[model samples]
Target: MLSNPRTVEKTALDEFISQYKAYIPKPALVKSEPVGGTLSEQIKRSVTVLDFVGQFVELSPAGRGLCPFHDDHRQSFSVNAEKNYWHCFAGCGGGSIIDFWMKWQDVDFGQAVKELARTLLKDRR
Candidate 1:
């Protein structure tokens, strides 16, 4: 939550963006290795779905957690470390880190991939 009431907007996206930027510095975005299949492939290979999502949501040993996208009662959200993908059984959809990022940030595929490169490349790989 924003402490200053004069702030423009206080949406979840704003908070998420703030936390994400703090976690990954701006300078680190260009420090990634350029030796992957493609942009999206490189981003996905940089970090696993389990590790990435685990940063924001606490996951059990089975890679299960309360879905952050919805009012999840059960631990409908699960990550496949081996496969490097996540799925929310509550109909929220499922895919790799880039997919989840796109949904979380409410951005398009291109923008999601760009942001993922910034976050995953610096220290994860």
Candidate 2:
């Protein structure tokens, strides 16, 4: 009854695939907000860069200090208490407290935020 066995098999397989393809379900969409927006702000306002960074590295009266991220003889790190920010003139880039924590702890952004949140929210209760 079949002239070409290969063509008949191919046609049957195509029909079978078409019949089952529509039964497959598509993945669901998920919407989520990024971590550490308001909490980071709260910590930035409440904690100064000098006070926070001072715990790790000793700072001069002018807020200039050694950068732990790099090896150097001179202290090229500067912390601006008013702006609650820091920067390393030698090379190491600086930012908010979260940024410092991420580099120091060698963790990702989410882990850093969670770690910071634990300390920041400790006294809330």
Candidate 3:
């Protein structure tokens, strides 16, 4: 039942940019635009899985916590610090920091990357 994500995602991304374009620093926006491999890698390297996802979910020791993507009664979400990725053994997919953000935020790939870039850019200054 996965709908065509491109259209919805594009609209969402466009809305986000239009709403926050004035607020985003020019330099940060440049890095995330087009959402390609180079920029994606840069953003991924700049962020830690625990640190980025921690803002949204409360993680316990060893990065074990309940899955935020599902109503789980057990600890199924695991964040691998060494690999900088996360997985929900309960069946939810896993990926880099941007992937986690995209699923949780229900936004497109570019939108997720852009938000991460924005945060990283703010920290640089």
Which prediction has the highest TM-score against the true structure? 1
Model 1 vs. true fold: TM: 0.68
* Model 3 alpha-carbon miss at residue 21, Å: 54
Put down candidate 1 lDDT per residue, 86-110, tens digits, no spaces.
9999999999888898889999999
lDDT string, candidate 3, 3-64, tens digits: 66555776687787799889877664544444445667878878698888888878997998
Name the top lDDT candidate.
Answer: 1
Model 2: CA > 4 A from native: 1-37
lDDT of 1 at 36: 57
TM-score of each: 0.68, 0.67, 0.65
Winner by TM-score between candidate 2 and candidate 1: 1
User: How far is 4's C-alpha from truth in model 3 (Å)?
Assistant: 57
Worst lDDT window (10 residues) for model 3?
28-37
Tell how far residue 124 is off in model 2, in angstroms.
1.4
Candidate 1 residue pairs in clash (backbone atoms < 3 Å): none
TM-score of 3: 0.65
